[model samples]
Target: MKAVVIGGGIAGLLAARVLTESFDDVVVLERDKLSDEPEYRAGVPQGRHVHGLLVRGGEIMEGLFPGLRDELVRSGAHLMDAGEMRILNPLGWVASGRSGMPLLVVSRPLLETHIRRRVTAKIVDDAHVTGLTFRGSTVDGVLTRDGRIDADLVVDASGRSSKLPAWLAEAGIAVPEPEVVDSRTGYATRLYTAPPEIPVVVAESLSAPDTPRGGIVMRIEGDRVMVTAQGAGGDHPPRDPEGFQQFLDSLRGPIAGMLADAEPVTPVYLFARTASRRIAFEQVTGWPGGLVAIGDAVCVFNPVYGQGMTVAAMAALLFRRHSDFSAKGCRDFQRKVAKTAQGSWVLSSNADQSWAGVEKTPAPLMRAFRWYMKKWQVALVHDQDIFLRFLRVVHLVASPATLMNPVVFRRLAKYSRLDPRPGRRRAARSPR
Candidate 1:
């Protein structure tokens, strides 16, 4: 069997790696030459920002490439027990305890390099995949600059700029109507020397309705810390030193002071194209066979939430189960992968809609759910067990059902009397 993968980003590399295990031959075609070192490339615009490998994503990566976690640690990435990290939510300090899962903090480029090294397939660089070449109802191959590369299966792991839907339309297939949710958000990021006093992963502040400003500082590879500040709507972070420090100061408390003291390593970098978009490929009818799409190509989320790469890994793992590297493989794979992405998509989209100035109102259920979640957040800050349960769902290690269990519901009920006024201040001090 022969499998062809387009795009060399995390999703593409992951899918190709899995393909190598099952197919007789696997090839990856990338428009950009991949880097042996950790650096930004044109294909990935958000590479400069902080990226957290959730426990679930880290576990999946370790399963696919054994010893990868240890290798990453040796490479200077921080292996952090999630329990030790401090999170400041709207309610108060979420007490630290064993979270039952661990998170890995590393630069995005380094993580991509690690995956690229694990997948030993034939990589054709500077090869632009122009279109999908189909024969009748099944996809036969892809047309690139060099010509067609026929394959039994073709997976489009291309990132947010993927033109797969248009290519499909050119092949006489109806492109699915994508569910688009836009949150006009921006982020300013920079590298800093970690404070000698701070030793673990810390999420200083997360945006809430009252104060929609958040920032993170974590120990990444090379003993450096990556700090990112995010703002909603058009509330962009300033690039100048004074303005930048004020922007940090605007986010609740303490983190700004801590960051100001940390030595700066890189200039402040700003990025804005943060929107939540999900394509409904599964809902489309008469989809052809032998072609599939994965990763951000299927659903691109707000990067501030950090769901893109982790869910991409989970979706690729789902595709591996349904993949057959045959004529009907693409269609079958899409059907299954769509199911896998639905839960994460809903989780992220709803979260993105919770903010103001997102230009759209949350669904009725989403609005109510957020209201209920806020109450739970207040309770969880005081209850360690409840906090862990909520953290499990937020990290994608567990579903929303876990948040509704009898034990958690009991806690929420007990803490309902402590609910603050609906419009009260939501920001709190750092849990650390």
Candidate 2:
């Protein structure tokens, strides 16, 4: 069997890698010209920004491509314990300790390059997939500028810009309107040579409702660090160097002072498309056979939560586990994919609701959840166990329900008296 995967990005490459195990031939179609070396491409506009491989994501990728973590470290990527990273939440700084979760800090291009190199499938660059080719009710292939490429199966990993919905509509399939929640988040990022004086490996001050500004500084490959200044609820970081630095200085953390004298290696790059959107393909009537969508094609999360890549990895793993390719089987797989994304969608969309100007008001349950989460953040400040549980949930290693355990409820009740004011902590003095 032949499988055609559209978009040679991380999702597409990963899907192709998984397809190689079952399909006799697998081909990936990417619009941009991919190079052997790690470099930014136009297709991934946010490639220059700071990216994190969650502990669960790293574990999944390592399983798909063994020794991937070691290879990255060998190429200068930093492998550090996740708990060591300094994080300023809405309340205060989370206590630091070893959480047993390993974080692999690497550039997007580097990670993509390594994954692409490991994939045994054929990857065709500069190939633009316009639409799908249907054999009656089943999607048999994809249409490209060159010609029709037939396949027994077609996987859509075209990301947020995917045209699968339109293609299905044209084929008389009724697709449901995608659920969307936007916080109007924007990012301005720049790369800098790692200065000897900078002692932090990864530091972040997350944006909150009261304080819309946030910043992150993390070490990546090439002995360099990436600094991203971000804002939410329409407070966007400026693209100009002076303005960018000023924005950094406005953050609640010490990232600005840490990078005060660092030499910049790249110009400021701005990315503003951080909305959370989910296409409910499983809800569509008459879903086509021999077709599946993964990654951003199905759901796109706010990059601020650092959930997109991890969710994509989880979806690809779901695809790998699915064995049936019949019409009903395809529908079942799509439903499974949707189920897998539900947790992340909840985490990110609910968080975005905290920003001002969001149209969607939280339900009573969500409101209570948010209230509890605020107390949980306060608890995280001095409780290493709570911090580790939060880390595990965010990393996709544990269920969100774990945070609602009786132990956590008791902890929150204890910390309830210490209702730390939001965004009131003094600027972080130094990285832990």
Candidate 3:
């Protein structure tokens, strides 16, 4: 069987890698010129921002590619435990001990390039995909500007700017409306030389209700730390250095102190589109078979949550599990992938909605969950076991349902009464 994967980013590479196991031939179509080295491009605008392979994301990639993490480490990416990182969350400072999630701190382009090298699919960069070729209702292949490439299976791993809706509509198929939950958050990132004594990653969650902002400083390869300062509702992070410092100073913790006198390596890069979008592809009437959409093409979460790459890996896992290529099979895969994304969707949606000016109404269940989680975050500060479990959920290593256990709830209730605010340790503790 032949398979064609559109948008040769991480999602497409991983999908092609998996498809190579079953298909006789696989073609990866990319719009940008894929580079051998880690660098910039027009296709992945958000790739310039800081990215981390959340525990499960790294594990999923490792399972699929085998030794990819080691390659990243050898090539300069850092594979450290999340415990070594310092996090200042909304409730308070979380005490770090065991790094439960196998975290990989690396730039997006480097990761993409490494994965691209491993996948056996023939990648056609600079190939602009126009639409799909349909045989009755099944997608027989993809139609690019140059010519048509026939395939038995078509996987749309294109990022958020996917042409799926337009193609589906052009083919006389019903296009699914995207469900958008946006906080209108924006952030600016600048690269600086790694500080003398900085943790591999520092996630300072300015989760306070009045001034909800976020900041992250991650040590990537090439002895540099990428810092991202974010704000919501048009409250964007500044692009200038002096103003960027001001944004850093306003955080719950003063990362400015750590960045004190650090040499700037790159100018600030701004990314403002922080909306959570999901397409109900499964619910689309007369949905065609032999085609499936993955990655940001199907669902786009707030980048602050860092679930984008992880969820993409999870989608690859989903494809591997239900290895069916027929129309009914592909349609079933699309719906199942959405079902898998529900937990991750809720995790980020709850966080982004915590800020003001976010107009989306929370579901009754999410409303109740947020109410309980407010205390849970506070409890997380004082309790290590709860913190670990919560981290597991955030990392996609465990189910969100685990947090609802009666025993866990009882503990949270006890902590809730004792410490209403939850994060007991607000002061920054230098990494051990």
Q: Whose lDDT is greatest here?
A: 2
Off by over 4 Å in 2: 423-425
Q: What is the C-alpha lDDT of each candidate?
A: 0.78, 0.86, 0.83
lDDT tens digits, residue span 20-138, model 3? 88889999999998788988888888888988678988988899889999999998898777765777776566766685567888999889888888888899999999989999989
Models 1 onward score TM values of 0.94, 0.97, 0.95
Order the numbered candidates by TM-score, best leading. 2, 3, 1
Worst 10 residues of 3 by lDDT: 422-431
Ranking by lDDT: 2, 3, 1
**Candidate achieving the largest TM-score:** 2
Off by over 4 Å in 3: 360-364, 418-432
Give me candidate 2's TM-score against the actual structure: 0.97
Q: Candidate 3: give the clashing pairs.
A: 289-327, 378-422
Task: Give lDDT tens digits, candidate 1, residues 203-229.
Answer: 644444565677787778877888888
